[model samples]
Target: MFREIPTVNRLLQKKWNDKDQQIHLQKLKNAKSTFNIKKRRSSSRRISKSTSKKDKIQEDRFKQIERDNKILLQKMRRIMKNHSGVNLPFEKGSLNKGMRKKQLADITLANYQLLQRLQDKKSNYNVLKWEKDRIDNKKLAQRIGIFSSTMVDPAHSKSKQALPTLKNPRESTTRMTKKRMKKNYQTELQPLEFPSSFPKRAKTTTRKRKRTIATPEEDGDKAKDLDLAKVCSIPEEREVIFQASKNDGKKYEVEISQTEDKMFIAAANKVKHSEHYLIELEKEKGEEILKEFNNNFQVILDNLKVISRRLVLLNPNINDPKRANTTRNRTRKKNFRKLNKRGNASQPSLRPGTVNSPSGDLMGVMPETARPVSPTQNTNDLQA
Candidate 1:
């Protein structure tokens, strides 16, 4: 048994020689062999302190990572909501280590890319509108003889100070989109309505056509009235009767002679026997042919039935792009084509000899008799 602290205190108070101190203070590898309790407990306490410090360091690092992640997510949400008017949530805690880092990096990259795209589109629209307004202003300036070339103002002042600077430069895209919650998704949706004073477009009507059948002329068919002799070079003779064979188109002639009548009678008797033999042969072969056809008739019927059943059972592809009958994909392609048409879209050309007012509404065209104001024109006459 190990002695208590009071025994160790009494031992320490007694002065001992160097060899006796060393023997008593010696440590052993085996726990049962060790006699000094304080030495063993002290060594264990040192090891425990090192392990605890390491665990504390690791725990602190994990907590720091968690805190930073929360802040990052908050900033991303704020940015998305401000720019796109959509508040999106990021998936957290579901990933760890490499997967977690990858998720956050992807989210940040996506956010920046989406932000850039939205801002660029908005800036591009603003730039196009600005260019259109500038062009319209130039045309108006030229019409009133206050163009940059003339360096004249509305008051017809010759001084440079009278003319407003035409260079209203545009701001950068970053500065433009820097505002938070700019879209402000609180506005109510409204249907568009044209003002009552707007002119109505002309309505086009389609005309329907009636189908009529043709009737024969009252003068009778033209083919029956025409003489065949006038159209063809072949001669029509009355001495010998001529008939054409329906099968071969060969012309047969009969002459009123005794030898010809005898030949015709003998030919008719031979033809009757040959015709009777041919009819009997056909009847003999017909039965064999019918038997052969009957063997495969059921098989042909079964194949037709199988094909019909497969067609009825097969499902039709509704949204497949490979199918030519897919109307959804076809309509999607049409919408893409419609969106592609925007490149050529521009504001309508200004009316000739006219200018838009300060309010952006187009002013009425000038009278034909009224000529353009020259640089030398008086200001009072223009005002009137």
Candidate 2:
């Protein structure tokens, strides 16, 4: 009923309160916009805060730089005022003797160290270079002795006698035979048969150690149950251990140690004495022998050749013919006839449990194998 008048007024009026309608429309737009508030206010506040923080930092840095420059200037002024012209921290005016001396020492030391460092690294740094070009791949290889050796190829050999030819045995047969003969002679070397030989070599006899019953208690209770031995490296340690030795009180016992050995080595320090006994010819002969032993390898080789030749001449009977057995009677071979009975059937035989059967022409017999289990005797023996 209240809206009927307003409806009639809206119909009657062509432009019914346009300004008021615009105001209402503007109010509605304002109300819709109010739902979306400006989020940039807090962001703008943060941005302002960051800018202020940056400004503060810049100001602090500038203040620090100014302070440092002021301190440096003050120090420079102090240095100029001082007699020593040193830039060390000083008292208001003059320093005490101790401080002055310390400052001078530090200054001198610094100057000396600076000079030394400059002397070592005197290369001109002003001249720029990409690289100094000191690349050497074989530097380490050059230092190693084996790498430095002139010989590199494994196939290259120096001696006329090349490696033994395994494919062709005849190629190295002469050398092989010679080496075998020399080895045989060396292994079977015996002293010359001398009628007046007084036998100077001592004949020592090895005494057997008495056997003791090794009980489990004795073995387990002993401190040396472990196979590993306690080793002492220091002299003091060994000395401390000497008192606990089992042979400490024994007069007949001899103690031997692994280290700190003062047992006078007769050959230490001094030039090795003449190996020649000097009982033979003269000093000249001795010197010649010494020189031959030390240097003249060819001469030694020649001497050895002569010795081998002499040995060949002396041992002309290298292959002794196999002598026939004149002493040993050659018995005629006994013919063993096969029998037709079990050789192991001894239960019904003359001797019970004996692995034997009646020896007869028809009895079965186990044939004896020709292969001899025992080593054959050398027919060339003096006994044979």
Candidate 3:
């Protein structure tokens, strides 16, 4: 019974082992299939993405090139329009660098042919000019008074005619002087004023000053005594005044110092009613002279007021030519410098028939050369 029980257990164990192996094999097969599908999908997606990025880059570059080409075409069209009068064989669409080279070569050939034709024409015109000059000389010789005559006059005619009688020189001078005098008398003369004088009115009249009445209450006041002492002690001083006059069309103001000499002269001029009263003097005329000085200053003040009014009426523009000339000159100098620089740049490469020389070489000197020594100086002095 033990042996039979062992055989049955072995058979059951073998069946369970076979079932487990089959389940594991199926799971491995399913896993391998899913893995292969996933790998294929990933590879296809990567390839599609790479192709899309490449296409996008290519499209962007093409668009940029097209934009640049359009801009270049517009610029070329503008040049063509500006030179519309010129007969160009190239089309607007074919104005690229390679096409321009061919066009330039064709133009050079055309210019060479035209120059040759012009040279031939110029030679022919020179020949015609020589012929015309020869014909003109022949015509000039045919006219009378131009060349020697062959036939002589039948009448008794001498080789040279007699000279006419000379007229008297005195008659010519007398005739000219009389004509000049007549002209002078016919011209009008300007009227002149004579030195004379008329009765003159006095510049001012002296008025009698009114006297003030003193109050009765101040007859015995102590304040009056103090005022009298102060007034009597005050010091006297000579006053100065300035006088202005026009001399040689220029204004001059002088401070006149009081002197005893001018005092008597001023009094005499005042009594005589003379126009030279300003140059005269008087001993008691100090106040009057000061008043005249003030009158002169008042006249100057009135003139200044008139000048101010004139300034208000006048409108001088700030941007006038006289004011802006300095600015214009600065601009002109700057432009001149720019032009000189441009001229130097344009001639950087020397021409075929020209020789290029440095400044020192043109001046007959070398940059490293030493100056000549003076004859009075000794060689030992130079060495020291």
Candidate 4:
């Protein structure tokens, strides 16, 4: 029995040995394949002697072509120098007059064609440059806030007058008056007066009052005395008294009297009459009707303001969120749904699923089912 158990163990060991041997054989075969691949790569990268010889031949041929080109260019330059006129170098000393004339005409025609080409190119370039300048000027005008017909064109600006002109009548009048004053002053000679030499005095006068004795009499007797005093005070008698004086000093008399005529009386009367007439006309026309309409309109505006204030007070939730929660919750739910929809639209599918999955499953094999039409595509289709 022990011998049979030992034979069974040997069989298991044999099976393990066969598996290990197969694994080692696979590793050795892989190593040999890799070595062969490296050898092939190295051999392919090596350059052949025949290719190097071919490269040298090609280089020599290119050099010869370059040298030939340079020699031809030098010969052409010499020929051009000898025949600088319209005549060709080959026909420079030819005795055939008709051939020379024909060559000269051909050269002139070629020159005219070249000149025309050059002129056309120049005109095209000028037109393009003018268009660019116009675009740049428009952009500059926009930046400078100048949007009106008065914006001057740079092309036509040269013909405009550059010097300043007198366009304002008031300014021109002031300049003319200043010139006239300067001319008048130039012809006149006057001595300048100094305030220190002639001191200024106040334009006011004072009078001496004559003393009168009060009479203790009745009102009628007082009135009679004043009349007699006034009759005795005569200007001629006073002048005679002054002339009879022995003193050589000058005598002056001042009189104070009230006059019925005034300089501003007529003007004051006319102004008062005009003001009274205007007041009467205004009353007769009932101009207060305009004031009544203005007052009523103002009252209506005030009432509207009051109603708006009351409405604002009643609906505080319009600005304040703490006043109500139902509206806030509704708005939050709407915004949340909108954000979820946008996220679903923007995210790509990373897992296998049906095309019509409610949660936005995008995996599918068919082209029409794999990709969904976006809002932008719909808008483009509509526009088209």
Clashes of each: 0, 6, 3, 0
Quickly count the clashes in candidate 3. 3
lDDT of each: 0.38, 0.35, 0.40, 0.38
For model 2, how does the per-residue alpha-carbon lDDT over 1-384 read when each residue is reduced to its tens digit?
Answer: 223444466744636556668889998888754365665456888899999999999999999999999999998788778856445885575548789899999999999999999876756652323222222223443343233222322333234355864566656557889899788555434322434645465576798768753223323224332111222111333221111112111111111222243210010001111110101112343343435335433322222211211110011111112312223222101111111132322121111100111122221112222321112334233120
Candidate 1 structure quality by residue, lDDT tens digits, 135-245: 678677765442243343344324534566464358444644544324421111221343567455667668665754333333334423332222221233412222111
* C-alpha TM-score for every candidate: 0.14, 0.14, 0.13, 0.14
lDDT of 4 at 306: 15
Candidate 4, 87-143: lDDT as tens digits: 755635557888989999999999999999887562325565677678778777755
Clashing pairs in 2: 339-363, 339-364, 340-362, 340-363, 340-364, 341-364
Model 2 error, position 119 (Å): 42
Q: Highest lDDT among the candidates is held by which one?
A: 3
* Root-mean-square deviation of every model: 45.2, 35.0, 42.8, 45.2
User: Of the pair 1 and 2, which is ahead by TM-score?
Assistant: 2
Clashing pairs in 3: 263-282, 266-280, 266-281
Model 1 residue pairs with clashes: none
Superposed model 3: Cα runs more than 4 Å off: 1-95, 122-143, 146-384
- Stretches > 4 Å off in candidate 4: 1-96, 112-384
Which residue window of length 10 is worst by lDDT in model 4?
262-271
Q: Write the per-residue lDDT of candidate 3 for residues 1-384, one digit (tens) a residue.
A: 123344558878778778998999999888744354443556888999999999999999999999999999998999888976667686566548898999899999999999998875633355656776765665555442222222122133223455855878775567888788677544312113333764466577588668643322322333222221122221123233433332322222222334543321111111111112112234455334345334454332222111211101111112234543565344434544564665541221111111112211221111222322334444343220
* lDDT accuracy of residue 214 in candidate 2: 28
